[model samples]
Target: MSDFLVVGGGVIGMMTTLQLADAGHSVTLLERGRCGREASWAGGGIVSPLYPWRHSAPVSRLATWSEGFYPELALRLFEETGVDPEYRQKGLLYLRVDDEAQAERWAREVGKPLERVSADFLYAKEPQAAPGFDDALWMPTLGSIRNPRLGQALRCRLEAMPRVTLREGSEVTGFRQSAARVTGVETADGIVEGDHTIVCGGAWAAELLERVWMALPVRPVKGQMILFEAPPGLVNRVVLMDGRYVIPRADGRVLAGSTLEETGFDKTTDAEAKASLRASAIGIVPALAECEVEHHWAGLRPGSPDGVPFIGAVPGLEGLHVNAGHYRNGLVLAPASTHLLVDALLGREPILDPVPYRLEGRVTSRR
Candidate 1:
């Protein structure tokens, strides 16, 4: 069996490594920081992104497949790891922000369950919801999970895998290349040798590949969010409006976020961002304004120009692969990405066509 060296320890890397190890391959995972504490932990944990219909066909394909696969994965992980990721179907209440017609048409075309609600129904469902201009769209099957708990579950399962070695706090400084193929990884301590190397480094993927002259257009797009300690039922559903959302955790915490900025790799949370998010949250669900600010933080999403992830074997580079540039849907897309990558590595007929997500090319994500 071939051994693999996987970079980065976020959800994408960890999940992929876990799948690889289970497939009877020896795997070594390197993490620069504590595993799962980065964007994976900081995320809002929505199983489906706010506006899924706007993404490209490849993206939508992966996302739709993932939506069907997550429940089973979550259940299996919980049984084995004793950590519940709190996957729940709280549904989504998309307050009409942009063109309601566009949202409705997209929903029907994509076959996503979107029900139009009268203002009275909206008021009844979320009484504290800020008085909105009439129209509302509700999706009954959208899901969510506590991202940190999901990360923890994966970490625990990975630690118990027989042939998997996880090196936490070990920073991968560079890769060892031998004429177009990556042979191993160079970490802060020493060189860790492997036959195949996969880079899933979120925002840092492009820079790391640049060291080997392999160009991947992955950059850090910072997103800031605020957490509020509200009553358990303060926000019944994921209330989304104007690119911001308020997600309610099972344990009385509501997360309101996030602002997308091309601010390089800076993951700083300023007062303005906090205020903006909180204001958005209150505007959507007025009751949250009284909730105490629990914490505020930021994360760097691996953003591509078109929001499409590079998810196949790198062209001209034998034995090298990547699964990054997920932007806002890393958690939602992790399971499907793993299946897609494991198939590519094991040389099995992939469950779906892999051409659209090939390593090369920039595909537009939104129309």
Candidate 2:
């Protein structure tokens, strides 16, 4: 069995470790801080892309393939770790959608369930939604997961695996290389040797690649979110409108997010963002105005071109791979991304074409 070093412990890294370990490979997951406390923990966990048609075909393919795994994966995690990811297919409603015709055509092409609902039907499904909205595009098959819980569950499962080693608070400072081939990585503690090293360091992936004299397109795009402890049914399904979303949990917690700021690596929450998000949340569901804000936080998404992640071998470098740059859709796309990474590493036929994710053409010129 191969020894693999997975750098980063977000959903992507953890999922990769799980897949590799399941395949009888030994995995060491190294995290700079607590696993899942970054974007993966902070995300709203909409299992599907906010607007599936708006994303590229590669992004859609990964998300669609990953969608099939959540129900079973969630149950398995719960059964194995007793932490319910709270994966649910409650559906997503795109209120005030920009183009119904385009959405319908894309839905038809994808063969995913899509329905145009009048305001009456929309209100019936989400009674708390604000009034005066003419209609919405509903994708009933879409769903969400509580990502923080998901992270907890994954951590628990990984810790239970005999072949998996989780190094929390262990930062990968650089690579251990043999000529053009990466042998492993250099941690603060010392050298950690492995047969293969995969950089899944989320927003910091670009920095890691830079250490190897390589360039990557991944950058840290800051996003902020606000939460409310409203009633369980306050926001029934995942609601998206004008690029904002409100995701409801099983319990009495509701999350409304987010702002896509190009601020580099700045995760500090702003009062302005909180106020704006609060306004947006109350605008969508007026009853939310009655609920006090429970939490306001920010996370750095590993932003890439068109929100498509890089998920293959770093060209010109052997024994090195990467699976980051899944901005916004990381949680939804985790299963497929990890599976494809493992498939490529093990020389197995991939479930999806990996061409779109290669870093050769996508990486920016050296900074």
Candidate 3:
């Protein structure tokens, strides 16, 4: 039996398997589709949450850890795989705040220093933006990464490690367990037995565990994104105007998103979502008005009710652990979440507080 049977192949699952393999553990990763083609692929690749001060302390802690970890991790991955993930820190601009008092309060809550810029400074920094707000807050530490390349880097690096086995096109249908211990995973091909199993399937986590009578409260939140092909440096940095955001990639692609819906697993992009995202992009950067949209797509974020991911061993179940339900901040929290879960699995002290991430009577396997 392998040391771990990880279900799902998004950033969370990929990270879990990657880290475990790094620690000299035998891991087999099972995926329903091509690895990283789900939410991780469609995301805007913003390294920080939008107004992180609004999230809970638990969420913020994981985001903080990942923010510090990604730059170093990306560099190492690029060196190993020869694929540059393009980790860039051009900063994030928050435009049109209601008042300075609110912005300052949020900055204090998040424990991040913000530079307030007046109209002249803002116009000089972002010449493409429409003139409206007199002042805005600039988050210098905020950054972005090319998530598709990041996923590719992870897959390439992991595949080179002999201890790791990656199985794409393998959908997990159920589980093989004894009275209290999970023994294997039931897949489309056959039963793959393992000593332990972890479900990191994002939105599909709940559905996969439900076949085994586990009640994880994870739901799908659909977000649509619009991509624009702009000249290099058309937008200097990531811009947040009103309640929406526009992210400029290093390869001359600007991403504007997204609409949140409770649609169950449906990834269809409608005209209304496309138009709404286009309006948001043009409203902030008037220069984008001349830019044509290159593509439009949707992704499903695994959302929990309180937004804190469920990252602990399932109650009343042995050899079964889970790390899913990260909502919109999945990409930012992937590194820390995977580390914490792996530490817990090995019976070692976790770096982050595990109390807020524990699943109990509400979402136990016995339920």
- Candidate whose lDDT is highest: 2
Query: For residues 1-367, could you state the per-residue lDDT of candidate 3 as single tens digits?
Result: 7999999999999999988998889999999898889999999889988877777889989998999888998999999999998898888888976665766786787688787888888888788887777888888888898899999999898789999999999999998989989998998799999999999999999998888788899999999999999998888788997778998888788999888999999999999989999999999998898999999999999989988999988777798889999999889999999999999988788998888898875585545
Which candidate do you rate higher for lDDT, 1 or 3? 3
Q: How accurate locally is residue 39 in candidate 1, as Cα lDDT from 0 to 100? A: 91
Instruction: Please report the TM-score between candidate 3 and the true structure.
Output: 0.97
Q: What lDDT would candidate 3 get against the real structure?
A: 0.89
lDDT of 1 by residue, 181-201 (tens): 888888779999898888889
lDDT of 1: 0.85
What lDDT would candidate 2 get against the real structure? Answer: 0.91
**lDDT ranking of the models:** 2, 3, 1
- Compared with the true structure, model 2 gives a TM-score of 0.97
Using all chains and alpha carbons, the TM-scores for the candidates as numbered come to 0.95, 0.97, 0.97
Once fitted onto the true fold, the runs of candidate 2 whose alpha carbons sit more than 4 angstroms away are 364-367
TM-score of 1: 0.95
Model 3 poorest 10 in a row by lDDT? 358-367
Among residues 3 or more apart in sequence or in different chains, the pairs in candidate 2 whose N, CA or C atoms overlap within 3 Å are none
Q: lDDT values of the candidates?
A: 0.85, 0.91, 0.89
Better of 2 and 3 by TM-score: 2
Model 1 pairs whose backbones collide: none
Per-model root-mean-square deviation over C-alphas? 3.2, 1.4, 1.4
